[model samples]
Target: MKKLIYCVLLISNVLLFNSCTDDKPIFIADLGSEKIAFTNNFASEYLLSKDTKNNIADRFIWNASILGVNSNYEVQAAIDEAFTKPVSIGVSKQTNITVLVSQLLELVDQLGLDEDPKTTDSTGKPNNSGVVYFRVKSKIGNGGAGTQEIISTTHMINIKLIEKVPTSTTCNPLWIVGDAIKNVGWNFSKTTVCDSDVQRVKVSLQNGKFRFFTAENNWATGLNFEYYKGKGYTIDARFKSEGAGDNNFDFIGTPGIYELVVDTSKKTIVLNPSGSFWAVGDATPGGWNFTGGETAIVETSPDIWQATFKFSAGVFRFFKTQGQWDINNNYAYYKNAGYTIDTKLENDGSGDANFKFVGTPGTYTVKINAIDKTIKLN
Candidate 1:
């Protein structure tokens, strides 16, 4: 019994020794370096707006090794190098952060020598060529405590300085309009006249076409027309006799092949050789026309008219029109001799009226027929 007890005690002591030898605590020393890279270029200017007044510390300090840096690095450029030691531009205590240069800096940086170097220039300003460096040490118990020992250094780029010349008094066509006017205001073609604001100019093109005047002018039968799709076209725009006499109108489309036709017929005037007629006062060009002699009486109304003219595909504008009439009479008289008449045309159910023709030239045939056939007595 004594010999068996001795054997069991020996085995237990061996097992305890083996366990103690296999278990050991591990110690690892982390001494890794951290870097915060940046460039002093035009693109870097955004950092100034981002770090305004240096009150926001989050933008500057990226890692524990470079803590306390803010976006105020831009103001550092104006600082006098005579100051005691290198000042901190930006610092962050975060483990990892990425910094970008201002767009302006990036632009100027690309131009090799538009800016000066470290030495003061004739104006006695410090040269901005030198790059700024940063470092950060982590505090105990902080998650980034291990990175505190690392230090990062980088330099600002040197750029050449260029002289500014006074702008010329002469105006440049391209610069006069600038980028703002490229696509502003409502697109006239897509919007109705009632929806458009006053004084808005819209552009449209037709080979040769005519449109009506609005009720604001007593709904005169005289309308706006243009022609420029052929050798050249003519425009005939009639207005209230008191407004303006028939003045030679300009065409908005290609200046060569279209023409505007004004039909003073009191009855329905077919705009196309086909049987359709345009509503009096309703300007429907790209249609047809009929003639009225001195004694021939045609009715007048405040409706739109139509006429069709053969045209090749092209952009055109009914820019201007011309007519002759007495101030007291709203009816337009042919240049020779004629009396004014009225056509009683009203607005199509929609309570809106305006005299503006803006359209694009397409191959599709347009038919302009009249509505409410009553004739007006002037």
Candidate 2:
């Protein structure tokens, strides 16, 4: 009977071991798995806009940090004052989550990501190429009855500092009314000046075209001229002589038979005109006077003759010598009723001559050049 009892106990032990083996294996879920990721393309430094939603399971959280030394990282989050409320399309429960973000070089600790915790090394050291980490947790409850914790997957985003290249663009100068050539982006340095940048873009008035140049082939700032699009006026230039070796000269309030010469070699312009000249005895010339006026004389060479006078809008008649035809109007005549030459009887040939006008209250400049022997105004 004792042997039978011992055998029975052994049989029961074997049965129990077999039963345990037949049971299913226990499975543990990977709590370190991530459902989402965040990546920085290094496009813009500031947040363009928010793209968050109110859905519980579909919500997203983003953070960044500049990796620094000694485990000190400056952090910033997408949930700053700029993104106070999440952009929502439908009704959903909102949960408060803090996102720490900062420059990439300051990040120290990194959460467990889905694939692997990408760090400077396996021991969590600083790396030349930095990483931004985001930790998010969701809570759903009102007062105390329905509180629940939902933790998001940790996401590690890789980042690298890169140097940007400069760029430029070019286009034709002429465009139709109400039309615009757009998207001409240019890269500019902090030290660029308006004159240098303007000169970099060459405008050809002869061919109505422009050329842009830069160091690289990138999108550049573009410029275009719209013809007859709106009300505009032409820039009329003239010359006036204060006196010999005198830089101060008033612009002649007349336009005709003037010499428009631009010598780019010396960066100077000389305008010489003949016949009726107007002058103001005082500093301000309100109108043309026939007597008691300062004589407008020509000066030495290499002078900026056209730049001496201020310009305004008005019709000015200039005395064109015989055989000197007008470019705009072909009609040419001498001693016509409209043509008036006031020759003073001064033996010195330095007397006041006035040109009469019946027009609007616009500005004008009369240029008299004794060397060129021509009278013109605009």
Candidate 3:
């Protein structure tokens, strides 16, 4: 009986040792070959506006389930493709998220793409449009940065700001200096117009050359301006490339007393002829003048258009040409709101296509920006 008990104890101890040695370590999650990726295709371009701020810009979706673990998605945006400094636009526990225009605007503003038309990027493109890099940092938990995360492949999307005028605007004047003007030769103070605020001026220039300068006697390299794009300085075209090496506007046209206008809203400088954008209706003088320039909105600064007139409460619409009702610039073109600021910009498809001018009958300035696609009445 004693011998049998010893053998049983020795066998039991050996069995216990084998069981402990053979047991595997506690189960640790492994990513293995599983990875996260955006499933839905992204739009190549996104044009954002204040009117459609609530509208969804993009619905970012990705392949669901990471090792059957409940993970979170962090959407980030950066100016560069490498995402040097990323701004988290959204965080979602679900597999997808809807990003609003306002949300993207925040990123656009952060990226410095929402700047005024006067600003240009490093590549000389307007700051209003550029490529924004995006990526999804999926984390194993709902916690933010530094958590166990698996980042998805980066994708770039082009974003453009259509408008920036949320409030008041001031048109900065550009003096037509250089030896082109008959009397004023490179003297910025003999500026075509004495008042810096005045955008349009009649200056007499001899058959020579002239370039637009910012301030008095400031002949700095970048402070001057010339034609933008590859196009030459024609009768009526946008010409406002400031730092282009050869910045002289050769006045091959008839040299005499000509009206030079500096328009900031369209970033265009024009001579005499001013009627690119016009407002028409029974609300003002030259009521849809079967002719042009009667209710013409002149260019004050680069890309900024301005005009003032005595207005009565009535319906009006903007058009490129006079004599007919062609709906190019309508009330709905500015914003969907029935009214903006003080005027009633009634928005609809049917008969309310025109904007309603409200309030006291007096002189008011109308500012229109073609690039921004916005109108302001003040």
Candidate 4:
């Protein structure tokens, strides 16, 4: 009776195991009408510059799905419309990503971009600008047998290499036109000064939008360069020739006397608060616009740079580059502020240690000797 019961239980277990194994269905990954597409506003043009390498050039966002499959999205850019060998800008599991100036620079190289504005392509357009094609590539599953891939339709955007500074030192002056300035305002009647040689203008400016024009009041004629402070990057660039909306330099500075110096060649506009100099601080005319490329002195001789400016009673320092505070010459660097009005150099770092013009505040000649590391004032 015991052997009979054990045989019946074993037969039942075997029958159950066979039914479970044979009745199951084999599932396959179906990759039919699934697709990926961009779902964000794209800029009509992208401006790139070496100065703003740390800034975000553009933001790419897309929507993708593949039902039960996990999808990985990659943002890619190429000079060719048909991405023969696309360079991957970035990859993510999310739906969006920001491309940095450094990444765009890499694409610029692959596109054979020329920094020189004079260099032109076969179509007679400048090589400094070109069209860049971008797309999102989505993939599912592992890279084994059942790996699936889908590429979104390509999108093109005009890419321009911003001319941070002009290649040549040739000076091309521009006219000032904005509600901010007093005399020559945005109205076409009183728009410009009409003198091409008048590049720099000292005037009182309020909060408004301004642009540099080669021809008086007319934006379409020859070269009516507009200043852009760079949206996501540090690009001192001109506008896209469109005369509306974002085609003006939004003024953001101390509402005082300013010297509006426009470098039409470089597409840069510098509003020197007071005046520009190699060294500027609370004391100098270009008050604390420290990195605004305002050279204080002229190289009268080889190692000597001296010039005269109406300095107030405040400390000032020198900067190597405009709009950058890294490398500079401070009061402590002078070593000898002994003969100057203050007769002392602040014992602080680059931040506070500067030469202050004490006592009577008036126009004074400042002489700096780079070799001796000494400063003389008169």
Candidate 5:
């Protein structure tokens, strides 16, 4: 009876193992091949001088991969046949992308394809006259599963040659138009001159929006350029006012007195906080020590500063800040006591002599022109 019971239990265990094996499902390989390709939708030629509106440079037409549900596509162009060094012309999740003629020309020159004079056709004619190669790449996955990459075949096209138009070197007049700027006076009609050649101004402004203008406080008739906000200190901010129409640049930084450097020729605007100007020496009313005692120079004009004080028989110079005699702080000036009365402020590292009070110790007034680096005594 014991042997018969053990045999029945072994049969039951074998049947349970067979049932478990039959329920297990097999996983077939679902891998798919990713293939990408590009097509030239327009003519094989392009000219830089032509200003046509709808000149199609190239169109990237590719097949969708079965494994990739939402694959990203990037169109590439290069000078090499292997596309080892290709420039990305456009990127999108769509299977097709159309590049403009202007953009393709820019890429051709950037890839150094226009500089090659060795590529020739069957007739020995130079084919390197702006020959460009195009390709497409597809990336299949978004970090959720296995990622696969595929590259397309290279396509070639010739770009026509044209005369290069020179960019304008003459700068137009620029003005700052905003409600936050008030210290320099809201007289938008007045162009505040900061540098001799570079149009600039020192204005007290609040954290708000501002923009550059060609006309006085007018945005419709004149040229205007707009850029994004939160630009760091003294950055060479640049923008083209050609197609920007009428838009204002956002300023979301701390509010204070700022120095604006505007160049219309290069279409750039740079802003830096204006450093404090003080008169610290024997001739100043605050004495010769600048550690604690210093005479603050009031900014009468944009970059011009003025101060009036009784002078003793001694020497003095200008200080940008109160701290030390580093390059950014203190400097001497070259003074001409002749009929012209010119003062050459030492901005270079050249050592200069201090301004000497030659007259008798008495009550006198002094004016400092920080822009032209001149001084007037009366």
Candidate 6:
């Protein structure tokens, strides 16, 4: 019995020793070198035209390195060399990225460049060619754990602005009236004239063609505009009506809502494919009249629409387009009482759930962010 007890004690000691040796060593990655180099494809100047499809821009290439254990790469552009206001251009695993002319122009606009070509920089330098700086950031791990970010040297990029807007100006095209439009019957006066604020209008049409007009009723459709077929949303092949020509826009596809954003200063038009999101029901100001004032949600921002209308003590639901029940309808509601900021509401397929206003009837605000797929009620 003494020998058996001795063998059991020896086995327990061996088991404990093996358990202590089982853990693997934690590996810490290197923070990598501070310096990074870009490849030969980098250019000093890039010409940005309105139509960037046919034009080939600059493709930035760089050498890849093991910055850390799991190194990821991102590119950023900024107006200032110090990167005070940086805009992320691209983030990817690849070491190369093609900076499109359209993207470069967008970055320039976001950097608060003025519309006039003769605009000056802060240092009294002529900024006719919008100069921007690009750099690359190589990062490891997810910043929460073992992570390090290494930035590359700033590269100069002078964006040459072509297709400058002509000095001539025309009146704002408020409503699109034509036979191709679903409700409009080519009669401007009796037709439901689409309104515009800040030279932008949200137009919903079937698979048809239409033309823009300045007046709400009758007379003549002045300063009409037409889009090229292969131009996509950019106004590359835009043809404006000088006098006698009719420039009709052919919208052939699924019948949905679209937003026509016109920049008179730049002489550019962006017809974006968008959702016809709005609210309508007894709780809304227009009540059941979906096509009238209650359902007309204004675009407060790009793809973010809001309206401050009077709501009655009732319930309402959101839809992409009014009167098209089977089309783009979101038949769901916010659970509990209502939704706060950035609250994502669910779509109930064919369910009849709706948002209710339990408080007294007065002026209220409803906002729908189609880009983020969220709603806000105030």
- Candidate No. with top TM-score: 4
Which portions of model 6 show Cα errors greater than 4 Å?
1-29, 51-54, 67-71, 114-126, 141-144, 163-378
**Compared to the true structure, candidate 5 yields what TM-score?**
0.39
Q: Rate the local accuracy (lDDT) of all candidates.
A: 0.28, 0.29, 0.65, 0.63, 0.58, 0.60
All candidates: TM-score: 0.22, 0.18, 0.39, 0.43, 0.39, 0.35
Top-down TM-score ranking:
4, 3, 5, 6, 1, 2
Ranking of models by lDDT = 3, 4, 6, 5, 2, 1
lDDT value for model 3: 0.65
lDDT digits (tens) for residues 41-119 of candidate 1: 2222122222222221112333333342222222122122332343333334334333333432433343322333344
The TM-score that candidate 3 achieves is 0.39
Q: Write the per-residue lDDT of candidate 6 for residues 1-378, one digit (tens) a residue.
A: 999999999999999999899877877655665456676444446656665433335557777765444446788888889888788877878887756566787765765554455667798865546778889888665466667677888888677665344444444446556665555657563222222223665555565556666667644644444333233334523323323356566555565555566654455566567644677778876676655655677765545778888877776676655554321133333332243333223332323445556666678677777556666667
Compose the digit string of candidate 2's lDDT tens values, residues 43-91: 2121111111111111232332211111211222222233232222122
Question: Clashes in model 6: which pairs?
Answer: 188-217, 189-217, 276-320
Compared with the true structure, what per-residue lDDT tens digits does model 3 show for residues 1-378? Answer: 999999999999999999999897876456555578887656657888877787656577787655544556788878787888888878888777767788788777777775476778898877787678878876553243423667888888788888454443455556667676777776665444433333577666566666766666667632334333343323343233324465676666665555686544455557874344678876777665546535877665444578989887667777665544444366764565332433444443443366776667778888876546567777
Q: Judged by lDDT, which candidate is best?
A: 3
- The deviation in Å at residue 229 for candidate 6 is 49
| Candidate 4 runs further than 4 Å off | 1-21, 24-29, 141-145, 164-378
Better-scoring candidate (TM-score), 3 or 4: 4
